[model samples]
Target: MGMRLWKDMQQIVGAGFTHDTGLPTWFEVAKATFLQETYQKWLLYKDDCVKMIETELVPQGGLFCNRTFDRYACWPDTPADSMVNISCPFYLPWFDKVSQGVVRRSCGPTGIWDEDDNGQVWRDKSQCEDELEVTAQELWLKQLMVSFRMLYTIGYSLSLSTLTMALIILLSFRKLHCTRNYIHANFFLSFILRAVSVIVKDTMLERHWGREIVKHSDVSDMLSHQAAIGCRIAQVMMQYCVLANHHWCFGEALYLYYVLIASVFIDNNKLLPYICVGWGMPVLFVVPWVVMKLLKENKECWAFNENMNYWWIIRCPILFASLINFMIFLRVIKVILSKLRASSNQRGYPDYKLRLAKATLTLIPLFGIHELIFIFATDEQTTGLLRYIKVFFTLFLNSFQGFIVAVLYCYANKEVRSELKRKSHNWRTEAVLMCCGQ
Candidate 1:
């Protein structure tokens, strides 16, 4: 047994234990530490199992099979042509269930352990895998995650297309170069960049970080220096873009609030403050989060936020922006309602209702009031049907945000529509004149 283990260790370690092995990289050193701790713990477990198996009874009757150990569980001697049952092994590292069940192994008539279809000793303990069984809840969660990914993918793709067209309209015409439109252009660009970043992050995680957790996998895929850095960088970029995107949304509301309160045209010079808030502010928080992660919790591709304080570094800013936007919306709504009541009441209630609905539609995305729907939802405590609804709605809101903003601000704006119409009419007239002259 000792010789066999030593030979197996040599085979497993290969040239790793040899004297000629040079200095390894940080990843390789970490890999070596993991392997060493794993093997040492495994050896200790094997010893404990062997010590417990020593007291098992031997076969008493004639024509009986001898006792055997299969490195995982020890089988006691049993009478020929019969089955034996023993307590399930507790030392299996992969199994976490209680060791109360019995495992049955057969002794052949020829006084040998019965061979399985693969011609090897077999034992049945299917009832003992608490950690291995995929429960209905787990299956449901997996399906839900897949569906959410699909939903977000579609949403981001649509947003990308619509936002691109909106941005082109904002930029192509020189007349649309006011402070407000420039702010609109920045908002569109932020969402466009965010959509692209999200798509790339998802792809990189699936490919580089392993889409699914595998069982009993080998160490060959454990330490890829490139994939590790790539996925972490992707995560960082996604976070930065997310912060920038949210800040830009807040910038939209800020500009709107300013315009409403000042009741005057904003100077192009005022655009710089909005740009700084939208593009530059995320760096302050993201840098600290990244530094803490690198120094404290660097594992798992910097994907998990096991530390809530660290996670709040990103969440707090977005929440603060949302809260401020909500307050601004309340004031803006007061102003809007006052104006509507003063101007549209003489036009009749039906026309007033139509204008109010239009204003509500525009304000929801503009002020990010729609996001307050999910603010109180804690995904961890949710269960059953409500959880599904919340998750789906949250994904829906996140995925289609760019599209909603583009619709409310650019595609649905009167100025944008008029500009497009004028441009089209001018191009058609120019084409007619050239044709006539030719």
Candidate 2:
């Protein structure tokens, strides 16, 4: 099959030179794309021919029929007249000046022959490389990667700072350590860690840094692998933090729903169980996924390129959490509307529905409605204006979610403002006393 294919290729190349043949057909054009593979197969045939010559015929000295027992000796010694219709057994390197595909030269009275103006007998592989288009595509892809790195770097930095501030506010103020604030603090902490992990992952995976590591390493085999320790750690930590954030949101909704439906305050001591579930359940889910991924395909960073099952490991939990939270939200809304309906004009009721709408807007991050946008807008179709819209939308929402949480739960709250004012007044009083003493 390989020999016949080579002979047919020669005929095709010969036919290509004839003006009567006109342009190459579609199949011939398609065949031109396989030039590299054709060359490799021709090499294989040469190897086989050499092996047959080496094994079958014993060389009298270092020569065979006055020729060295090398590639030339492997050539079939057919008569010059008989070679007209028969294909040459030897492989000759030839460059297609037109289609840039590989062709071969037939053995004449002399040995294998290929001569051009350069006097180089080797194949002109320059034509095989689509340098213009391939390089452009590679550079284009690199630009996209750089842009993503910059976006995530800036976004995560902003998120990390805001989330840290939110955490400090929630933790420092005893008055703010309510059940809702506690859950929000958990989410804030998780998001902060997640942002840090993203930064670290980006740093470790930076092309220059990775290349530098390999360059500086003395042990050739040690630092040569794709899955570096730092990158793998970052991947695991990022996954854990993401899962923890989802679980914390689920915990928040569950707590609120329980309070509304059961009409009882969950004792401060009882929070230990919820805390265990919120933080520890993520470990349960993430560990199995990490172990399975390492066992199955221990490739670079356990990234998204793996089998679909690994993806479902993380996504399924988040989706389930979101679905449950949505159901809880519906129940909570039902309860609020029931109470509003019960209270008539005699009670001088405000627009509770408007309040509910505002509250739902604040809960967008918690309830996972934002995921629907990603689900419907397929990434493949997300190009041009839609791509930019998605980028900006995600940049604002993900990067500034911590800021939104702080504003809604801390700065906007009456109790937090009062506590801040009281602390400021005390600080001023103490400063005046200290200055007088000095």
Candidate 3:
């Protein structure tokens, strides 16, 4: 049967290819996507089956499904009304492509080869179809991943460029040197680290996952064998940067609250405590998470947080900072409203309320309060449209935060704009004097 199938494949390849006169043209032919390199194994397997059947040759014992060779597997004489499974053929195209799983062949009563609706003998490699279906799903997800990564990659690149420009501008003029700009510089630095770390982590995972999944190696084993330590370090740094960025936003809110609402002055541009909270506090959570991961759930390049406890360890500080910043936002708004009311004694109540609503909307991004809606994230298991919306929004916001902050605080600031204008005028005057002298 195998030999005849092989000839049929040759015949299908060309019109005058076959030497045999009669072929089981009625038999359903397997698609010839098998690897040519594996043809030897196929022949050896087929020969062994033929020899075994010949040695144990027996007349049909009542009703029995005849021993047959189809696709690559040699089906043994199955008893009537019974089904059997054969290990999937590795030589087939999808064998090594998808992860291995259960395979089954169907048979009906009366002990004959399975028949299709057309009354033709059928090869029901149901699991092969399943593997193909899985392959299709995976292909779809891969395309989606590529698209999302592109979106975030562009965002991070844009953010990084803007942040560098903002930092340079902040540092260029000594007149702008205050506690506020100092915090801004540190905030920009955190975002720089964040963008770099995220890019690095993504690159590492692509290499690791691409190699491991395709080759059918266990993820843990692949990580252990490859650049596991470096990848883990990248993961740690990414967490630290993310923590610092969010905490710095909290610092921004706190400083505003203190100076404006509490009427307290920070003497001599002192920001040691704020600096510690922004850069140092992440260490506390990161260290513990790393220790716990090493002791408990060390595997797979440390890319995914399989342990919810570990995830919360990193997340709790970020959430705490966000929530506190939001409270400070409300407090600052209330104070500003009261002061506005006292100063604008002639204004109507409705007018002040309208202004308050605008102020709230404006402060949402300034305090990073808008992130409250996206604070909770969906996991890999999350499906359907909700998951997609969350993923896109969360990724877009996270990646472009540096650019957004730079635009709002540095590029769009009246003070910064005035400084740049003054500098430009001074440079123009110097150039004119030089030309006059010449």
Candidate 4:
């Protein structure tokens, strides 16, 4: 009699499982077994059947067992079989009510349990998958942290050195504040901003200090959003400033060649505006693009894709600027060689020939090859490794620019060296007096 009642319940549930169409063999058997057990439990405790299934059986035993069975027994190709075993048990009326209530309260009306006419829930599966993938990739961020630390160290050190060298030169040799030094001062200013950006972005991403600050702050969300916006602006400005420095360097080299080789001279005061244009144009071009991107793209962080067209917009100008600088370097070389040949013929000895050759060789490692690395390495779709390499090289190369320029143009001249030494001694004496007074 009991077996007959269980079979009757199975027939009812089995009919529901198979609509007008057919059902899979495995799904039919699983549905029959589930209905038979549910009917037996219902008979034993009629009022407590729903409570037992909802609280203890379905939540603990039914869901857990169904999940395990589906994982191992379900055919990979049969979506119907998989769905029946994994999903149908959750629709047992009581479980459905509890699940719906909990989901509605936590996720609102458009919650996970909200089903369409086809009885399929409209959940954002892609969002869940993306979160899972990001969590998995968190381990790789350690490497990025290391790279960021290295870049910050190199950039900060180089920027400070460049600024110190420039300040010393400006104060000690006031007479040497010509067109070149003026342009260099602007470059140093930009480098300072770049250094600050690097340190801020690196610290935020790697150190978790922002997270700690947010824990303690009252208006954490507003502060974080502002910081994010500021960081993005800083990054874009830094890159534009770098390009501006390259442009100014190219212009300086052109001016030098025009004066020395082409016998063309322009007044220093008249050339100041052109110098300003070299630095100013890049900022103008980059600011609009950044503003538009900020309006459209994600605002939670500063990253490469903030301006998707950054490479396309900036590449042409940078390449053109690099080419112009290379042309100036070639002209300088040609002029030096011509002078050396003339000197050697007149004196029957190598006068400026060895010195010029040595200077050119030294510059190959300093300016020529260093800039070439940047030109060659800057691809539109740079990967993390490539980005790291580019930043590392930029920091390493530019860090030495001020030192090399000081050595070649300043120390090489006896007058500038004498003035630098005298200024260094005076600075040291003043520093000692201040410390002693304190």
Using all chains and alpha carbons, the TM-scores for the candidates as numbered come to 0.71, 0.64, 0.67, 0.56
- Per model, how many backbone clashes are there? 0, 0, 0, 0
Q: What is the RMSD, in Å, between candidate 3 and the native fold over all Cα?
A: 13.1
Which ten contiguous residues of candidate 4 have the minimum total lDDT?
67-76
Task: Write out the backbone clash pairs for model 4.
Answer: none
Q: How do these models rank on lDDT, best leading?
A: 1, 3, 2, 4
- Tell me the tens digit of each residue's lDDT in model 1 across 132-204: 4566976776566667767877888899999999999999998887888898889889988988876776555
Q: Output the worst ten-in-a-row residue range by lDDT, candidate 1.
A: 18-27
Q: Per-model C-alpha lDDT, please?
A: 0.71, 0.57, 0.68, 0.49
Error of 2 at 48 (Å): 11
Q: What is the lDDT of residue 176 in candidate 4?
A: 64
Residue 48 error for model 1, in Å? 8.4
Per TM-score, the best of the predicted structures is 1
Lowest-scoring 10 consecutive residues by lDDT in candidate 2? 18-27
Ranking by TM-score: 1, 3, 2, 4
> Model 1, which residues run further than 4 Å from truth?
1-94, 97-142, 211-227, 263-269, 345-350, 379-386
Instruction: Give the winner by lDDT: 2 or 4.
Output: 2
Of models 1 and 4, which has the larger TM-score? 1
lDDT of 3: 0.68
* Residue 231 error, candidate 3, Å: 1.3
lDDT of 3 by residue, 325-351 (tens): 978987898898997787568654547
